[model samples]
Target: MNALMAPFGGWNMPIQYAGIIAEHNWCRTKAALFDICHMGEFIFQGDFESGGLEDVFTFSVKSIPLGRSRYGFLLNEQGGIIDDLIVFRIAGDKVMIVVNAATAPKDFAVIRGRLRGGLFTDITAATGKLDLQGPLSRDVMVKLFGEAVAAIPYFKFITMNILGVEAIISRTGYTGELGYEIFIPAEKVCELWDLLLSDERVKPAGLGARDVLRLEVGYSLYGSDIDEETTPLEAGLEGFVNFDKTFVGKEALLRVKEQGVTRQKVAFEVAGRRSPRHHYDICSAEEIVGNVTSGVFSPVLGRGIGIGFVRPELSAIGTPLTINHERVSMEAVVCDLPFFKDGSVRA
Candidate 1:
C-alpha cells in the first residue's frame, strides 16, 4: 500500500491510497477498512460516585448502561470544549475513555486531576483500533468474526475473542454508514489489518477519504470544527450535554446559556464546483462574519460542502453568503447538516 503520508496529530498518517475520491466512493458502496490505531484509549476502574468519575464529562458516566457508549465533551472552567470524546461502559465499575490522539496527554492529565479514587491508566500503547464502515460492514464483520458481531446495535459493544485475544467490537463509526469500530491488542493490529483487507469486499482507506466521508455526514473533526476555544453550545452539540449533571463547567455553561451564543456553527453548500478551504472568509453581504473550519468538495453531492462558524443571524437555511480566500470566491448558502442524507447509518 503506497499511501501518501502526512503529519497529523504528531504522527505520520496516511492521507490517501489509490486516490481520495476513489476510496471515498468505495466506502459508500462497500466496506472500507481504516487504521485508526492512532486514537488514544484509557481505562478507569472504580466507583463512579466515590471515585469522582461521574462529574468528569458533560454526560453522567454512572448512567451509561453496561455494554453501551456515550458521546460528549470535556469542558474547561470557561465552558469551552477541551475535547469531545466517548465513554464506554465496560463493566459496572470500569469504563473505557476514547479520545483524539493529539489531545491524549492533556486529556489524561485533566481527567486524572478530576478523579479522587478511580484507578486510571493510559492504554494507548497497548490498545489498537480499526474501523470498518459502509452498508456491507456488518456482513463482512459477521463473516470474519461470528454471529455476535451481527447482534450489536448502534452505540452498543460486546467483548469477544478474536485472534485468541479479547477484543471490543462496537457498532459505531465516523462515517454515516452501518459500521463497527474494533479495539484489540496493539500487538495484533497488523494481523487484524491483514485479515480484514484479505476480504475482497474490503478496501483500505486513508485519512483523506475519512475526512471527506465524515464531513459529508456532518461529523465534526476535533481540531478543525471543535476545539478548546469552542463551546458545545456554539458548535450545535448541546444535545450531548446534560444540564442536570454537575460537571466542571456547569456554571460557565449556564452563564453562556443566559448570555446567548455570539456565533453558531453552520453547514453550507457551494453553488459550484469550487471548494471552500479552511480559514476562508465567510461573508454575509459585504461583511465577513466568520471563517471556514472544515471544507471539502463532496463527491456525493457533486458540490462543495463546509462547516463553519458564523453570526447567528447569518446561519439560517437558505441565507446566501460568499466564501472567499485571496483571489478565490464562491457563492454559497447555509444548509442543513448531513449534506448526503441517504446513508445507511441506521440500517
Candidate 2:
C-alpha cells in the first residue's frame, strides 16, 4: 500500500491508507481499523487514596467502577490542562492511565511526583492498541472473540484472551461510532491487526481519517484544540471536571469560575466547501475574536466544520463569523456540536 506518512509525537505514522475522505466515509458506514499503538499507557498499583492517585487528576480515580473508564484531564496549579486522558479502573488496587504519545514523559514525571506510595510503571512499549470502529464493529468483534465481546457496553471493558494472550478489549473509541479499543501484547499486535483486516468488512484506516471522524463528533484533539494553556472550562469541558473533588488546580478553577472566562470554545460550520485551518483568525465584523483550533471538510455533512475559541459573547448559536488566513476567508456560523449527529456510538 502506498500510504502517505507523517511525523506525529516522535513516530512516523500513516496519514492515510487509501484517502482521507474515502476512509472517513467507510468508518461512518462500515468498519475502519486503526493502529493506535503509538499512544502511551501506564500502570499504577496500590491504594488509590493513600497513594495520592485520587487527587492527581480532575476526577476521582478510586470512584471509577471496575471494568469502566472515565475521561478527564491532568492540570497544573494554574488550572491549565496538562493532558486530557482516560483512566481505566482495572481493579481495586490498579488502574491503567492512557495518555497522548507526545506528553508521555512529562505526564509520567508529574504523576510519579504526586504519588507518595504506589507501584507505577510505563507500559507503552509492552502494549499495542488497535481500534475497530463503525456501526458494524460490534458484530465483527462478537464473531471474532465470541459472544463475550458483545456483552461489554460503552465505557466498559473486559479482560479476554486474544490469540491466546490476555488482552483488554474496551468499548471506547475516538470515532463517533460503535467501536472497541483492544490492547494486546506488543508482539501480537501485527497478528491481530492482520486478522481483523482479513474480514471483508474491515479496512485499514489512518490518522487522517481518525481526525476527521473525531472532529465530526465534536471530540477535541489534544495539543490542537486543548492544551497546557487552556482550562477545561475555557474548552467547554467542565462536565469532565469534578469540582467536588480536591485536585491540583481546583483553587485556580474556582477562581476562574468566579471571575468568569473571557473566551470560550465554540463549534461552527462553514457556508460551503471551504475548509478552515488551524491558526486561522476568527473575526466578527472587523475585529479578530479568536483563532481556529481544528477544522476539516466534512464528508458526512458535505460542508466545512471547525472549532475555535472566541469571546464569551460570540459563542452563541447562529452568530456569524469569518475564518481568515492570509487571503483565504470563509463565512461560518456558530452551531451545535457534532455537525454529524446520527452516529452509532451508543448503539
Clashes of 1: 0
Q: Estimate each model's TM-score.
A: 0.99, 0.99
- In candidate 1 the C-alpha lDDT for residue 226 amounts to 96
Model 2 lDDT tens row, 145-248? 99999989999999999998999999999999999999999999999999998888999899999999999999999999999899999999999999998999
RMSD of each: 0.7, 0.7
Least accurate 10 contiguous residues by lDDT in model 1: 6-15
Backbone steric clashes in candidate 2, count: 0
Clashing pairs in 1: none
As a whole number from 0 to 100, the lDDT of residue 170 in candidate 2 is 96
Q: List runs of model 1 lying over 4 Å from the truth.
A: none
Q: Model 1: per-residue lDDT, tens digit, 1-347? A: 99999988887888899899999999999999998989999999999989999999999999999999999999999988899999999999999999999999999999999999979999998999999999999999999998988889999999999999999999999999999999999999999999999999999999999999999999999989999899999999999999987998889989989999999999999998889988999998789999999999999999999999999888899999999998999999999988999988889
lDDT of each: 0.94, 0.95
